[model samples]
Target: MLKPILKLLALCAFCWAFFASADVLTVRQDAPERYVVKKGDTLWDISALYLSEPWRWPQLWRMNPQIDNPHLIFPGDVLKLVYGPDGRPMLVRDNRVVRLSPRTRVTDTRPDAVTTLPLAMIRPFLTHDKLMTAEQLNGQPYILGASSNVKNATEGHILYARGELEPGKGYAIYRRGKAYIDPETKDELGHELNLVATSRAFRAGNAANNEPASLQVMDARREIRQGDVVLPSIDGEALPAYFHMSRPELAVEGLIIDTTSNLREFSKWDIVIINRGTNEQLQPGNMLNIVRPSPTVVDGNDGKPVYLEDSSRYQRLARNFGHEQITMPREMVGHLMVFKVADRASYAIVTDTFRPVRVGDHIISP
Candidate 1:
């Protein structure tokens, strides 16, 4: 179920103050006067149909307080665009209803309401990825062996692990992935626990007797091999039913440390890992702008290749000719919203991309 509608409204009100500029609402030129909410339509997708920036959805909802439970949107509901008293555009629900005697009308609505983004795209990251500190990585239980003394195991195989574990509980099998390092500070942020498979603890281990616990492989994304670490399955409760898109409360400057599936270049709808999280006060729903440094080139040169500030070749040529360097302004390539926050890193999904974003790109408050 989604959070209480009142809380969502309050969050929208709080974020309204942070808008960079106060311009009249910019509705799309092709915006429809009335739209019927359809199945599989997300709040963002619907908003994009009317507003230039879909993240301003909460703002659009806030304009019409007369509509009850506006955030609990359902399919078949009719949304009509009307002007408020101040001549500002607002979206109002126009569900046809009969005015019978004073009584609460009951109707069956799906428990899963329309949310901000497509849940299917982020479900795997929510279920499979877990960031771990060095200590936690070292302390996790690892696969000892498989049934019939096999070195590798797959689904339906019985595997043995050595560690303290609760019987009959589900756990995720993982292997240590790349360690994240801050591009600017060069500090080790954390390591990624790449999920391999899932298993249920059939028997708990006895540390005093040096006995290993047995597990039944319930599912496999790949072969569940010996030496793979086992960690508690990430809870589905982490998936919020609904959240408002907002900017981080604090000023945070960080880099895109990595991408999901080791992608060389990522665009809209892709998941990325950044080096700022709880440490930088990042929270779910916070939006960040992906920025790329503009190229710097030799001044007064025709078709010369772009050069870095510290390029030795540029330094040698500049010393001889005394030509100045021209640095272009940084440009924003994309926008992303944080959906999960860890200790020193966070998982964000790309919402918009003007150009392909890459690792090492900088992220700033939108």
Candidate 2:
């Protein structure tokens, strides 16, 4: 008789324990009680540093709709983090909201000077073009140098070669290369800039084989110097109008507000992050696409996968697998692209296994 009763008691105890350990949404405890907005600070950066994650900022801000625009949380605004019964974090604005009033000080007191001149127009110059074969030109190893003290060139910086390989008095130099990230994370955030440019070769090689050449800045800023890797310019027609302009603004749609788990592997065709929000233009139920990095293969014979080289055992396996001749110990895997976005950290799915989506997958722009 007691045996059945004891078993029933044990079952009830197990059920109680499960519910006790389960996480239920409640007010947070350690809410940031204070914050001072500074110049040039974006709400994204502040949310990441103060909250568990930046994407959660909307939830925190939703607690108080009177705060107005989320972007309006600008410099001089004071923020306060609050907590409720569940021990979750919440945000509040303090008396500092009134600091946005206009200032009376004016520093620029000088009178404005007006000058009007008809727009000066210069006639376009007409020149003859000539083509030279590879044998007609003398080629020298190019050395790149920089004037901005940056070891690696970035966007808008100028780069030039210091060797003698001249056509006329002044010819243009340009760079064309693909941009990628080191230790590739297969995430959208990991993508780095791949810059290309074209400029004129200035001072001719006057003295020795190692002499420097005079270079002039044409389009981009002239900062990079000899020893920087650059390719010869390619002659082409003008690019499309959209190529020179910024991308169009995307409409805010939906968001991946919550995730069931934190451990996720991102692959191709996974949703990453979304920019829309309640404050922006996003709402619930809108759909967004997830993107992942394209698959890359490495060979086994090579040492390893480096930025410029992919010589790994995996690469060899991939090659063998392509032929379908025999089975080798080669593995095919993918990468993830994470967008830390300064304050907001999110990831996109980079690999696809026809399995369940995980935490670190992408939620891309909609």
Top-scoring candidate (lDDT): 1
Native-to-model Cα distance after best TM-score fit, residue 97 in candidate 2, in Å = 4.5
By TM-score, the best candidate is 1
Candidate 1, residues 1-366, lDDT tens digits: the string is: 366788888788777855633646778999999999998888877888998777777877764544444557788889888887866778887885434445664443667667788888888767677777786577678999988777678998988998978998999899788888888888878888778998999899987899999899998998777889998875565675567788789988888999985889988889899999897899889988899989786653555544656456755477447665767888999888899888899989988788999999999986
Model 2 C-alpha lDDT per residue in residues 1-366, reported as the tens digit of each score: 999999999999998988964433333345456877766454444664564333345555655543643444545667777665656555767754433335542232222211010001100000111112223223533446654666655445433465664533434432222222212243222111122334555456654776665455455433343443333444452221111111114543222322212334433434333322333333322223433333343434444433213344544556656422222232223222222121122222232233444442234442
The Cα error of candidate 1 at residue 309, in Å, is 9.3
Error of 1 at 106 (Å): 5.1
Give the alpha-carbon lDDT of every model: 0.81, 0.38
Name the runs in model 1 displaced over 4 angstroms.
1-31, 36-40, 63-71, 74-77, 86-88, 95-108, 111-113, 234-238, 300-322
Query: Roughly what TM-score does model 2 have, to 2 decimal places?
Result: 0.28
Question: Distance from true position, residue 235, model 2, in Å?
Answer: 23
TM-score (all chains, Cα) for each model: 0.79, 0.28
